[model samples]
Target: MDGFYAAYLTGRAGSGLLLFAIRGPTFIGVDGGGVKYDGQIEVVDVGLKCTIVYMIPAGTPNLITGASPPATDQRIPLEFILPKDFWNGQVVGITTPLGPVNARFQKLRDW
Candidate 1:
């Protein structure tokens, strides 16, 4: 799926933009405008799956399960890709610059 992320720089902080194209293995996430486009990200376990809520610079994260998909490959219809394997009855936490977010398990008919 296509998602949009925007960051603004204030008096002290610099402006930044993150564009993520998550289709296959090679998850393309880029951040620029302030710091050099050379940085890293760390993923932590959140009961259900580990996720890198904070990614610095050109820090890139790959899809946990699938092989790196082609840059131009199309996403599977109605597929919801999660950071980690989640049990049907389990709850998971998602962390970001904003804060921790919670998610509940739900079954989908397809994908």
Candidate 2:
């Protein structure tokens, strides 16, 4: 199956974009500005949370997760990429530094 899906991380305190390509492991998901052209994202726990690691300026690796060595405020910008095999529908609650945000994952049968 040629999997294709999209997600948006809105309600950001400032302007930012969360974009994922239909194909490939590269994305620049922070709206209205200069973001890195390449990065990798891995979603875990059936979309419950994701550990986003990106290396910008060539050496610095930035990571975002619910809890870890890279703990971060939920208010910070984040993104997700579901695998093609993911089929469960769920509504995820993300607590940001601003407030609570909900993201829904519904399977789209068509393009």
Candidate 3:
């Protein structure tokens, strides 16, 4: 699935809690999920907030897009993205995949 797609937190039954593909040397991972500030909900927190940003290449339709509320057992928030601003780094989605683990990223076009 390319262009505008959605990723749900299927489960925490493995190595890392969040799973995704990104366009960087990083773990294709976002920041906040690994640690928790005092008031900030840690990725392990029950109602954490996660955000994902993707860098889209040119020529993609509906550069900005959103997804339906995940139909899974998790309570992910409604996501928003602006493909134009995302030319260098597009904003993907945001949600608490698990406890305090809020995940977010920018999907870089693979082409």
For model 1, residues 1-111, the per-residue Cα lDDT tens digits are 222223221211222344443332323444443222222222336322222232222322232222242344222211123444342545444333333334443333321
- In terms of TM-score, the best-performing candidate is 2
On a 0 to 100 scale, what is the lDDT of residue 27 in model 1? 32
Number of the predicted model whose lDDT against the real structure is largest: 2
Q: What is the lDDT, from 0 to 100, of the residue 29 in candidate 2?
A: 38
Q: Candidate 1 — which residues are off by over 4 angstroms?
A: 1-84
Where is model 2 more than 4 Å wrong at Cα? Answer: 6-39, 43-75, 79-87, 107-111
Q: Number of clashes in every candidate structure? A: 2, 7, 17
- In candidate 1, clashing pairs total 2
Model 1 scores what on Cα lDDT?
0.31
TM-score: model 1 vs. ground truth: 0.26
Q: Can you write out model 3's per-residue Cα lDDT over 1-111, one digit (the tens) per residue? A: 123212322223322223343222222332113311111111323332324333322332221122222333222333222233332333333333232222233344452
Displacement of the residue 94 alpha carbon in candidate 3, Å: 6.2
The estimated TM-scores of all candidates read 0.26, 0.34, 0.22
TM-score of 3: 0.22
Tens-digit lDDT track of model 2 for 1-111: 223333333332322334334233333333233233344444456632333433223222222222222233223344454444543445445564334444443344433
**lDDT against the true structure, each candidate:** 0.31, 0.37, 0.28
